[model samples]
Target: MGGDHTISYPILQAISGFRVVGAEECWHKSLTPLMKEVREQMGDGPVYISFDIDAIDPGFCPGTGTPEMGGLTPIQALEIVRGCRGLNIVGCDVVEVSPPYDFEGTTALQGAHLLFEMLCVLPGVQYSR
Candidate 1:
């Protein structure tokens, strides 16, 4: 969920078992389309999820190295992680949280929560409220 998005390219390549493709930034009100496309492509295969905190709006995730405007909201970020509920998520991570810049701890809190969300969705995890 954090760190350099470019790193995804190399990681995808290293896996060799999946498609090694570049990622395109998505700016929209909904992520369903993008998620659907990805889910279809994955087709029940084991997948690793990585979320960059920079994907959240700087107002919400200012601690990230690459803060961008018009990024996802904290709510949207949670939904994205939670949306993986039925997928074969082998493992996941949230990255790019720089606390030195997060004076109010908003970004760090969100990053930690997203990481927990990732864990909840992993295959065989017994999710609970």
Candidate 2:
């Protein structure tokens, strides 16, 4: 949910069929509405969720190569993922977790939790842990 200005908008826009939401939009707006818009944009297509740990605030997840300051809080991150409840999700991945920079594995743990949250929303998936 966090895309610092580091991403090249021109290149992202050049992609044939994709939507890009910047961090500012995510931060300022309520996640529920934002996510509703995302769902609308995605339509009925099968979705693949990809979460980068760096999308979370460094205060909550500080183990990535590029830790951006103004990022999503752990709760906010989860809420956003949970908001995808009825989407047709096919797969997902959480990346950019570097244990070396993590304190007591907080980042890793959050990554796992986020993954679980994502799984709970996917079709036919039940969270066991």
Candidate No. with top lDDT: 2
Worst 10 residues of 2 by lDDT: 1-10
Candidate 2 deviation (Cα RMSD): 5.7
| lDDT (tens digit, per residue) of candidate 2 on 1-116 | 23323444443433335677777777755688878877787777777777889988899899887899999888779878987878777666687888788868899899888887
Question: lDDT of all the models against the reference?
Answer: 0.73, 0.77
> What's each prediction's TM-score?
0.75, 0.79
- Backbone collision count in every prediction? 10, 0
What does the lDDT read for residue 60 in candidate 2? 88
Task: Kindly list the per-residue Cα lDDT of model 1 for residues 1-129, writing each as its tens digit.
Answer: 455555565356335254432223444456656566666777677677778888788988899777887777887777667777777776677778887898999999888988988888887889897
* Clash tally for model 1: 10
Task: Provide C-alpha RMSD values for all models, in order.
Answer: 4.1, 5.7
Pairs in clash, predicted candidate 1: 1-51, 1-52, 1-93, 1-94, 1-95, 2-94, 2-95, 2-96, 3-95, 3-96
